[model samples]
Structures are given as C-alpha cells and as structure tokens.
Target: MRKLSMAVLVLFLLTSFGIAEAAGSYWQRMAHGYPNQLVVYEYVYEYVSPELEITARVPQLAGASDVNWQDEFNASIRQEVQDLVASLQEAALESLELEQVFQAFPYVGIMDFEVKLNRGGLLSLAIVTYTFTGGAHGMTYYDYINVDLTTGRRLAFTDLFDTEAEIARAAQVINEKIAQEPEWYFIDQFTPGLIAADQGFFLTESQAVICFGLYELAPYAAGIQEFPVSAP
Candidate 1:
C-alpha cells in the first residue's frame, strides 16, 4: 500500500509538470532591414494552445482568411516592419532632397523589440526604442502587450484589475514609491491624480509595473521611471 501511494504521488507530479510545460509557447527572433539604413527586429511566437488567439491585427494579417494563429502573428509583425521601413525611407528621401536647405546630418532609423514576459498565458513585450529619420535625440518607448492565452484577445489595463479601487490603491503605492526617490522626478508636487489607468503598465507574477516615458514625468536625464507595485 505504501509503494502504491508513492507511485500515485509521482504520477500526479509528472502530470502536473507536463501540463505546465505544455502551457508555454516557443518564440524565435527575426529581423528585416533596408540596405544600409533602417532595420526592424521582432519576435514571432509559436502558439499551440487553442484557447489563445493573437487579436492584434495589421493590413496584411487582416486580409488572410486561411492562416493559422502563428502565421497571423508573423504576418502582423512583418506588416509592422514594412510600415516602419517605408516611413523611414520616405523621411530619408525627404532629408536627402532637403540636404542643401537644412544641411542636417544623414538620416537613419532603428527599431528593436523584446519579449519581456511570456508565461501563464499572458505575454508582454517592450518595444525598447524606435528612432525615425532625423531628430536631436531618439525617443525610447515601452509597449506592453498582454494577451489572455485562454481567450486570445489583447488585455487592457482594466482587464488585469478587478475594481477601480484596486487601481487607485496601486496608483497610491506607485506614487508613494516615487516620492521616496524625489530626486528621480522633476515634480514640485506629486498627486495621485497624476497616475492614470490609461497610462503604460505591465505585470509580473507578484507586481504591476507602472511606467513613464522619458521626459513624461521627469527630465530627460531621469530616463524612464518604472515603479512596481504589489499586485492586489
């Protein structure tokens, strides 16, 4: 009887491990570029779960009728790459045409992204930086894309929280943390109202990361401010 019980427990553990392993999807990095000018880098995920769908759409992915979820995902990334490259090319041509007028430096564009979190059916990504044609400085931004693997739809900030009260609490916590490092921000006064639900945010297993773009809440020297609050 003791041996039988031990065997049963081992079987249960193995089954649980199998389920966990099967829940995760694999991904691959891909890059596209234009001669010596613009380059776009992205990641493509291989989704195996029937419950999840990639709902983010682009022109190329929208027209396809028979493609699987993985194909649609790849197509969407490709469409984004094409759009980015085209925009940069247009700007580069304009810069060349106006080279004598403005006498500005040569134009080049760079876009790169990474998968920040991909587990338990929720996937998040950060589009680290995207710098087009010409500017005094390149703008760095974060893109958090969280999707419900079970539903296959992109989730908004509200979807992750149960109530407005929870959001308020999270905001309060973030504000408090920022206040502790007052030098990190440029505000003479910090208010809870400053933190909005529509603002950029992402989640980890234990915390929600609320972020601000460069110069949004502070000076450019301060860089991006990301405050992680305990998940409610």
Candidate 2:
C-alpha cells in the first residue's frame, strides 16, 4: 500500500468551533489562517492491508500565541502516532497465531482526539486511542493535554490547585462521586497514592475534570470516569 501525503491527509478532516472573540480567551485565536475564532485541523494517517489496519487522527495546530509551543506540541503528537503505529504493528505480529485460531480479520488500531475545553486562557484536549489484537475486546487509552496560553507552559493537576489541601479535596470530591456507585468502580484500587500530581485531566470554565483510562478503576462499560471539581 501507499502512504498519503500531508495535503491529502488534511483533506480528510478540518473543523473549527465558533469563538465569541471574548477578551483574554486564549483558545480563541486566528489559527490555520482562520482570520477569527480558534481552528483545529485533524491530521489523519491510515494503513490497511489484509493482515492489519491502523489509523491515527492527530490534531494539527498553527498560528498559536507562541510559535515555539505550537511546534513542540505538533511534533509530540506526530511522535505519539509513530509510536502507536510501531507498537500496534508489533502486537499484530505477536498475535498472529491467536488471530488464525480465532479466524479474525486484520488487527485493528485507531487513534483520535477531542477538544474537551478550549477557553479562559486554557486549552484542554483529550487524545484517545484503541487497539485490538485478537481479543474479545479492544483496549482504550486516554491522554490529557492542557496548555496555559499566557506562558505556553504545560499545566498539571497540581498546577490548578492553590495548595496541597485543595488537591486532596479534589480527590475527595472524586471519591464521593465514586461512592455513589461503588459497584461500578474498583474502589479498593483507588487509594490516596493513586492521586498522582500529574495525572490526566482537562479543564472547563469552573472545573478541572479528572481523566482515567479504560479498566483502570472500572470496567469498560463505565467509560471514562471523569470527575469535575472546582478550580480556576
């Protein structure tokens, strides 16, 4: 099979959400030649054959507040796509015997992203990818990318909290939500030590939404266990 050029890849997906042009809205910018409003264009890569199928939908950004940050972020996404391709390819090869036994089709792999929050001087995104190599179900992964527009710095969960106590309180809020439906989650696996300072999280106007991977704290039906806690 042949690989598609960047121009052809861009033709696959390109969209922009309306921005009110509000004052100090970092996510609202003239990106990718958009005179107004923030723009997000997806860079797609697909490879298909009788034995394997892999695709990655990476978000491409341009004309951000900081050129340096934009370059690094875009490069990072590309690298992630490359790594996924390589890893999935290896897994497909390793599972060749299992594939034949199960009479399965090509090993499938997919990667995509979502703009969870994009405003109020913060740009939060969720990168999601899935892979299935001869199994009853495919596995999913999540990566949260939060950017501080004013400084072009990557923000972590701790960065949003004023003090350690606030972070602990945020954890408490998440635990309380889990308590409501305790059976849906692996409550025992969720301990205080599990609250890593740089865990996956996105942001809203008033809440810092926590992110968890598939089967990390719950089953696949539970989806992503996101808890929104108060934060600036």
Question: Candidate 1's error at 127, in angstroms?
Answer: 1.9
lDDT of 2 by residue, 1-232 (tens): 1356765555443222222233323322312123323456799999986667888898977667667877888898999988888887777777775546324467788999998666554577888988877658888888888876546678877666547677678778878888888899987435556887678888665567887877878899999888887643
Instruction: List runs of model 2 lying over 4 Å from the truth.
Output: 1-38, 97-103, 188-192
For every candidate in turn, the CA RMSD to the true structure comes to: 12.8, 11.7
lDDT of each: 0.53, 0.71
TM-score of every candidate relative to the true structure: 0.63, 0.76
Which 10 successive residues of model 1 have the least lDDT summed?
28-37
The CA root-mean-square deviation of candidate 2, after full C-alpha superposition on the true structure, stands at 11.7
RMSD (Cα, Å) of model 1: 12.8
Q: Which ten residues in a row have the lowest lDDT in candidate 2?
A: 27-36
Clashing pairs in 1: 53-152
Top TM-score prediction, candidate number = 2
Native-to-model Cα distance after best TM-score fit, residue 33 in candidate 2, in Å: 22
